[model samples]
Every structure is written in structure tokens, then in C-alpha cells.
Target: MNVALYSTPRFGALKHTIQSEEQRNSSSGDDVAQPPSSPSNNSSHQHEDAQDLLSFGTHCDVKDCRQLDFLPFRCDSCTQTFCLDHRTYESHKCSAAPNQDIRIPECPKCQQKIQRPRGSDAAAQIQKHIASGCRDLVLLAPRRKCNHKGCKNTEALSFKCNRCEHQFCIKHMRVQDHTCSSQSIPPSGSDAHRLAKPGQSALKRAITAY
Candidate 1:
């Protein structure tokens, strides 16, 4: 019988044997398990869900019409929304615009020129006249003077209404009818009076009255 000679395993052969043993051990149920998710796979799933969630009109209930890009301003008179093309047309005139020129006279809805009753125009004219007269009185009254000792200055003692001739000092001219019997007496001569100069007194009186 012939016998073979036995030899020690080389370093590489020992390493390979050790690796094989490790691989077998790792395959057993006692080995640490890896997480099922991968970063790439998770990102893809998240992206798909985001796309589903971002759909704009899915929540809208309109059966056929989509959301309008632009909305129209509704006319108060006609109770209708006017599109851009029809906004400037005479048939859809804006009632809010001041009709100072009276060019667009007719009501776009009823097709009637808004009329002021005959006396209404007269009443408005009278109001404007009264306002102008009041302004004139305010402006002119400052030029008149009272003959009283302390009131001798050139400034009007009060505004005397042209119609009423009611005299009110410059202080009372704002609201009180100047023609009323109440006489606003100036401060008499005293130390307190001296401390308050004519101009200062007038200003203080005006402020107080105001």
C-alpha cells in the first residue's frame, strides 16, 4: 500500500476557510437582520404620494366647468358681472363714477337719465349759495372792528350776518349766529389781562371756543 504525504495549509487557504465559516454562520437565524427599506425606494414612493396629493381641482365639485382664471366685477344696478370687453361699453356704465360731466346720463340698467326733481336742483343751488355766503362771511368778518375799549383793534369784533346783522366776536363766529343777542365781552384791564396780550387772548378764546 502507497501513503500520501500530509502538508500544512497556506495563509490564503486558511483565510478562505475562515471566510467560508463566517458566511455560513451569518446565514443562520441568529445573524443581525437588515432593514427592508432602501433610501432610493423610499424616496420614489414619497414622490408618487406627493404628486397624488398636489392635484389642484380634484377637490372641486364643478360637474363640467373648470375654475375661471379671472372673475368680473358685478354691476350693482344690473346685478351682473361684466367681463373686460363689456366693462367700458355704454350699456354697462359704472354707477359709482361721479357724473359731474353728466355725459353718461342714463342708468345702464333702466336706460333712464337719473333726474333731479325741478326744485331739487334749486335746493342744491340754494345750498351751494348758502355755503358760499358762509365762506364769504368767515373771510370778511375778520376785517371789521368793534368800538369797545378792548375790542378797538381792526379785527372784526364778530361776524355780523348780512341778513341778521348779529354780532359775534371772532371766537364765536364759527357756530353761534353772530346776530344773536349774546355779546362776547373782551377781558377787562387787570394784571391777568395784561399778561394775556390781545393776540394771545384772541388765540386762547378761539381755541377755547373751538
Candidate 2:
């Protein structure tokens, strides 16, 4: 009877060990950790970032302007990159090149702005502008009439005397015809011009002086 009791206890301990092993296996299967990523994949991601950095260019070479850029202005002479504002040789002060040749022809008639064709003559373009009536080429003549009373002749307006407010033709531009006031008349020893009667034409006095 004692040997039978010992056999029963040994069997119970063996069964308990098997059940504990099953429970541990089930818990491990429920929470299995994933394997670590490969080094090749990490390297590929790093390579992609490097490629993106290589695609974009560096900053502008202009003074005090260090902005990142791509497709920048590349000078043919100096082969140096520059911003749009400093693309020219003069703007950047390039040592490899001088000033560029770009001249816009202007109209000689009225000095109007015009767009000129490549390899075209500037003089011909000016003539074309004048013919198109874009500018006046003819010398305009004056249409002002004579200031003398009862005179019906037109002449170029030239006189700006203070005594006579009106413009006069060449024939009537004299002070006698317009009856210039004493204040407007310059200092002269001639009594005919200084002592002329008021409201009366100075023509009679002028004729006597002449």
C-alpha cells in the first residue's frame, strides 16, 4: 500500500509540469516579438535622402544673399551661378567678361521709345516711326494774328512785352502799335516814348521818332 501511494504522487508531479509548459507556450504565441529590420533597407533609405540632397543646388553667390536655389542663372563667360538681379557681368562684376551689347533704338523725330528688330538699321526704324505718325517731324508754324487794331494778318507769336499783354505779328510787334504803358517801357531819353498821352496810340510819336 505505501508503494502504491508514492507512484500516485510522482504521476501528479509529472502531469503538473506538462500543463505549466503548455500555458507558457500559449502566452509566448500570443505576444511574439517581430524580428529587427535588415541593415540593407536602412541603407536604402539613407541613400534616398542623399539623392534628394544632391538634386537641389547650393545657395546664390551674391554678396549677403545665401539662399538655397535650383536652376540658377549660369554665366557663360565666367560659368559662375548668380541670382536674376545679378546675372549680368556688370551687376556681378565678373572678371571674365565686359558689358553686354544690347541697345534699344530711340526715335530721333520726337524721341519716342520703339522696339527694334534684330540686325535692323536704327535710322530706318526711326524713319518708319516718323512715317507711322507716332511722332511729328515737321516744324510747326505759329497761327497767332497781329495785335494792331484793324490789322488782319497772322504771324508767328514772339513778343512777350509786359506793357502789351497780347501777342503780336512781326509787323505789329512794335510798342507803338500796342501802346505800351510807361511802367512797361524801358528807361530811354526819348520823350516821345516816356511822355505819350494816355488812352492815345503811340504810333504818331513813334513815327515822329523814326
Candidate 3:
């Protein structure tokens, strides 16, 4: 009976020690299996969120075309934001297009076209064009006037005095009829040409009709 009691106590102590060992192993296994949250992954997620906020799309201001555009265009005339299709003044039917668009001023002297920018003086551009020696200006002033001192006559065709190299109308074409210099000066290189050109009358008639 004494040996049995000693052996039974030893067996109970051994069983308690085995149970404690199993409980510790199970708890350690659970700790090792679970993964810890990573700071770098959390930071990457936050960066993506910030980028989405920064790259937000803009809505087109046009009432009929309010499409969201990642890269919207702004109208210079109306000063309103719009999509690619409605960015131009004509496309949007802007009322202020005339004021902000480029201006083409017609030359008063030569009837030529010149481009003038928005909000700039068109007269200044025309003056610049004249200052640059407009080609049409020379063609427009093809008519020759009488060089007689007191006569204010200009004709579609004028006769040049071969003796004094002066231009005159048919009435004073003779050297004595108008006060010719009488010096028998050589005809000027400019006035040495024909008295009546073919297109002079037609050009003068067109100008008069206009």
C-alpha cells in the first residue's frame, strides 16, 4: 500500500507537468502564426489616397457639356472653364468673341487686309502698314495729275511734255499752252513712258465706281 501511494503521487505530478507544457506550446504557436501589420504598407495606402485627392478631375462649366475632364481647357474670351470640345469661342457660341478674337483691319488707303490683335489699336497697325510702303498704295495712285502751276486737273490719262519733262492734260499738252520750263531738259526717267496706258482708264473707272 505504501509503494502504491508514492507511485500515484508521482504519476499525478507528471500529468500536471505535461498539461502545462501543451498549453504553453499552443499559445506560442498562435503568436507565431499571426502576421503583424506593416507600417510601410499603411504608408503606401495613405500615399495613394493623397494622390487621388490631388489629381481630382474638373467638371466642365458648359451647361450642356458638364463632362468631367482630367485636363480641362479654359476659354480666353469668356474666362470660363470647359472641355476640349467646347473650349473655343465659336464652339461655345460666346457673346464676347468679337471683342476678344483677332481683329483684321482693312487699309483705308490701299484696301489691303492686316491682322490686329485683341485689345490693340487697329489704326496703329494700319499706320505701320503704310509706313512699311504698302504695294497697293503705289497701284492705287497710278493717275498722273497736270504739273501746270495753277491747274488742279487730274485725268485718267495725262500727256507728258517731252521738252520740259512735265505731265499735263490734253488741253495743255503743247509746250506753249502750259508754262513749260523751256530748258529742253531731258525727260525724267519716271515720266519718260507712254502717254496713255491700256489699263489706266479701266482702273480709274473702277475707283470712281467704288
Name the top TM-score candidate: 3
**Per-residue lDDT tens digits of candidate 1, residues 89-123?**
24344455334533322333333333333212322
Error of 2 at 186 (Å): 52
**What tens-digit string does per-residue lDDT give for candidate 2 at 1-210?**
887875897878998999999999998997887778999999999999988996787667877775566767787778888876666666677777734444766676576566654434345567777887965433345487766678788755556555757776676676765666536675445766656654255777777899
TM-score of 1: 0.20
Task: Give me the overall lDDT of model 1.
Answer: 0.47
Q: Per-prediction TM-score, please?
A: 0.20, 0.34, 0.36
- RMSD, every candidate, angstroms: 20.1, 16.5, 18.0
Clashing residue pairs for model 1: 144-156, 158-168, 166-178, 166-179, 167-178
Query: Across residues 12-33, which tens digit of lDDT does each residue of candidate 3 receive?
Result: 8988999999999999899888
C-alpha lDDT score of every prediction, in listed order: 0.47, 0.68, 0.76
Give candidate 2's total backbone clashes.
0
Clashes of each: 5, 0, 0
Off by over 4 Å in 2: 1-11, 23-32, 35-51, 105-210
List the pairs of residues colliding in candidate 3: none
* For model 1, the run of ten residues with the poorest summed lDDT: 56-65
